[model samples]
Target chain A: MPLLDVDYMLGLVPILLRYLPLTLQMAAVGMALALVLACGLAVIRVLRIPGLNAATLLFISFFRGTPLLVQLFLFYYGLPQLLAFLTQINGITATIMGLTLHFSAYMAESIRAAIVGVDRSQTEAALSIGMTNGQLMRRIVLPQATRVAVPTLMNYFIDMIKATSLAFTLGVTELMGATQKEAAGSFLYFEAFITVAIFYWLIVELLAWVQRRLETRLNEAYRR
Target chain B: MIKVEGLIKRFGGQAVLDGIDLAIEQGEIVVIIGPSGTGKSTLLRCLNFLERPDAGRLTIGDLNVDVTRATRADILTARRRTAFVFQNYALFANKTALQNIAEGLIVVNRWPKERAHARAREILERIGLADKADAYPASLSGGQQQRVGIGRAMAAQAEVILFDEPTSSLDPEWVEEVLGLMKRLAAERQTMLVVTHEMSFARDVADRVIFMEGGRIVEQGPPDQLFRAPQDPRTRDFLRQVLATQVALDVPD
Candidate 1:
């Protein structure tokens, strides 16, 4: 009856924490898959490899223009209708598919920009020293581009962690779904949601700490 | 030995290097001095096919390529036999000095990593940057970075080194060290073709000095004759203007 149930919020923390792994698992797997796909798309975009380049651009536009929640529904509901095999995929698989497709589009553009941002002189220097084009990219260009892309890529990863909360909409019992179930049974909606928010906040805070360490390590070469 | 014949390069339909003909014997130091935009840098860049001369022939050691018709293999072979130094050091930002020096050795020459690193260490010591081997380009002084750039060139053991205004971007304080390194390299009878505005370096280090104008070699001779008594009117006028500016800069305010 009170304005807030502090003790109940405290008690729900353990219950909500139980679902943290599911949330993390979704984010980790989705991000890993997205990063790999994004790198491929970025390389295609950078090279402008004939037919594949135009297709990559259209794919990026479609994924980026649509809402993530709508994309999730399409993957879960719409994909099964077109592809018979997809009908067997559970809610978790569909949610992951949605996340991977959505995030990779954004990541592809950022990675391409980072690669283009590398100094032209670096390429010239590599070529002058007898490096093949492939060697130039692998040894000189990408290493420098990695320095430029790390912060942006880490931002996308954090965005990915929060984006996983939307997985519950697909009927996947991730963090948000678990909270919804508990809230419905007890009718302590605010308390349950607040506990879930704290879990997400803690995870993001831990990740931010890791990102700082990674940035410091990458920036070591540039330090005066 | 290196030879370039009828090296022609055009930008926007205007010739930058118009039918250049040059040859250098092994261990000869040839210095090119000309007014800006006269194609001194372009000629050097064309030797390694960096600009892909419109029509020319380049022969270094036993390798020869027609610039207009050179294949990828020809360009790679040409580059392998020659090294270049830029006005801006252009050291790999992500690599340490040692790694930059060793990169060509391992990647281009296909030497084992340990052998490359060992050679890199000797080059670093020779360049007086032994203690900074682990330091990245960003942390080194401009002089030190350019030394590492030169070390990278040295580690290649190319038949000839092309220097394109190597000290032009340096702070005045840093210029002397780079030029001194070049002097030492020249003293060792290394084959080098240098384009620079440093009259003193040309006079002191170059075995032969070439004067270019309008994308052609207007005159060439020993540095004593070229600097002190240039025969061509264009060369004389260009040298007078450059020397006047040099004297003006040297005068205390």
Candidate 2:
């Protein structure tokens, strides 16, 4: 018996590729939702907003301390036991929730670092010109912070794309889920896994290219 | 007109500005000269509530704010009435030169964008940086950036402009251009309170000069009397040291 199945691996590409949209959908929705949630958390952390800040700290610690797979399982299988309304949540919704909460805890710190990294003089200058704290953040501070944040946020996004593979255990037929189904019937696990891995590698490489272009564009004003 | 009475600021247990009282007339250029760490910059920062004095009262025009109990409205009103030019230029790094000048007008005054841009363009022309409108702070030379910083302050058309050692951070070659722009502003009778180590510029432009040491004003007089014949021994010693340094720099290594 041959140790490899090159033809099966080649054929497996098309079958797995069929689930690319679902995989991208999960990552895209999770990334978009997480960005908003993460920015809010980062602001709360930066400002140290009284009682809300303590809760955010606990939320970040809980999400970041646990394994992503376990978090996905908790949302999929665990939450429904406590909350009756959560019982109707499908696997896709649960996976998206897991990704959003998990990644937002990490992204919030990066965003906060970027915001703080902005020079103190920038704040003073904005105030000297009569900017309220709110105006300063929107007009002066956040624009500069975004420049410092884009590269790191793109890194999180690429990680989120790979993390979508965890959605499979929740019974969502994404890229990895489809591969598992194909491998179970054919019993060619090596070919099936390698094809999905190649797809992930290609997606990461493509995003890294986009990241480079984006960083260059965002940093145009800063180039000496 | 601006008046700061019994202004006191502390950091930790130490007072950086200890019971300082000062007054400046409209369009008067008051130059503050002091040894480093003498609270000269802190005094200017306090007027706009940037440093938030622990105790004092700041009266600028009709708005009187007790520094210790200043509300957000008082702080905002004080800031709106005055503008600051920093030693580090502090031009918004993400913005172009034109945007830096226009930002105050748009944000503070709530002027229409076209009107703000038009005014900013005129100021750019006045500063002779009209050609570099699209250049970011990083792309400009230090002198150009400082010029933009001044232009930003100028665009506000505030009641007074506070310059905190605006030339201290510049390369030696760039100092004169900034000072020259300041001189032109002075010539126009603009109200300016400057903290600077440039004695020559202070001597030439200041309507009144103040010498501060250990967070207190030791002496103040017209620039001619202060520089030529200081009344206080402390002021004399400080000037002698400063002039000696300038003389030493004049000679080759």
Candidate 3:
């Protein structure tokens, strides 16, 4: 038996690449939904809205405390049994749901810190001028908070993209799922995994580049 | 006119503002001076309902709030009539100088963008920051930022402008520039309440100076009377400590 098979690994790269778009789509949809949910949660967390606060706290605690895989399984296998409306949820939907719920909890805290990290003066300034809370947040607090939270949010997105690999365990044939099948069919486990690993490394590199460019634009005002 | 009756605020178990009562006449520059941790800043905040007083009533022009029964709408109404200039300037870091000035007008007053921007630019010119209208707060010096903060308050057409140690966060050179702006506003007879450490500002610009310590107005009167002949011993001690530091700074090594 050959110790290594360069041809098999080289061929496996394209097989993995074929499924990369689905992986990206899963991450993109999940991250977008997560951002919106996180912002809402973060605001509720910040304001400590009466009855809603306990729910947000429970969500954050549950998501943060459990492993992502367990959450993915719960969504895939557990949710449909409990809720009639959720009975039709498919594997891909479940994967996205898990990613969004799991990541929203993390992003919410970052966004909350950014929102609260804004100077007390800024809130005072906005309020003293007669702005309602909604106007103040939309016009003053959120804009600044976005700048402060963008870097951290970008890092979350990168983590999210990688986390989409766990989607394969739910039987959604994303990149890692594609690689698992190819390796099983050819008995070239190392070749399949190395190819997938390179794909991950490249995706992270690409995202890092994008994050740097965005950070620079956002930081222009902060520079003297 | 601004009137506050029995305004009380607390933090944890300690009372921060202990039944404050005061009145400010129109076109008066009232300076509140006190040691750190005293309720001077809290009192200023209470006037506009920034730090909600636990009890009592506040009236600023037409906006009135009975602390015992004030609704959110009442607070908004009061805030509409007043403006606060923070110790740190508190300019919108994401906005240009003009945008910072125009934000309240556009967002709160519902002024058209064009009209609000025009007014903002005019205020910037009056504040001698017309050339810096496009600059972000981070790029501007502390003095410029504070001036923009002033411009923001002025643009609101507030009945009373509250300054919370406007010069506290500035460098020595920047302090005079800000004080000069405050002096001009005072000369125009803007109804204002200022909290400051600048004895000279309180001396030259204030119509009335209030000295506070331990959550109470220890003494209040014309600056001449308050500064030259403070009735309270605490006032005397605070002034002595502050003046000594000024003298120390002024002397050559």
**TM-score per candidate, chains pooled:** 0.95, 0.95, 0.87
Flag regions of model 2 displaced more than 4 Å. Answer: A1-14, B247-253
Q: Write the per-residue lDDT of candidate 3 for residues A13-33, one digit (tens) a residue.
A: 777778989999999999999
Better by lDDT, candidate 2 or 1: 2
Docking class of 3: medium
- For all candidates, the clash counts are 0, 0, 0
Q: What is the Cα-based TM-score of model 2?
A: 0.95
Clashing pairs in 3: none
Q: After superposition, how far is residue A143 of candidate 1 from its true place, in Å?
A: 1.3
Better of 1 and 3 by lDDT: 1
lDDT of candidate 2 over B1-253, digit per residue (tens): 9999999999997999999999999999999998999999999999878888999888999998788888998899999899999999999998999999999999989999999999999999999899999999999999999999999999988899999999999999999999999999999999999999998888889999999999899999998888877878888888888978763222111
| B1-253: candidate 3 lDDT, tens digit per residue | 8899888899997999888889999999999999999988898888778888899888877766788688888888888788889998888887899999999889988989999999998999899999998899999999999999999999988889999989999999899899999999999999999999998888888999999888988899998888778877888888888878663322111
Write model 1 residue lDDT over A17-36, tens digit each, in one string: 78888888889999999999
Interface RMSD of 1: 0.7
Per-residue alpha-carbon lDDT of candidate 2 for residues A1-119, written as tens digits (9 for 90 to 100): 78899999999887887899999999999999999999999999999999999999999999999999999999899999999999999999998999999999999999999999999
User: Candidate 2 or 3, higher TM-score?
Assistant: 2
TM-score value, chain A, candidate 1: 0.95
Q: Which residue window of length 10 is worst by lDDT in model 1 chain A? A: A10-19
lDDT: worst 10-residue window of model 2 chain A: A9-18
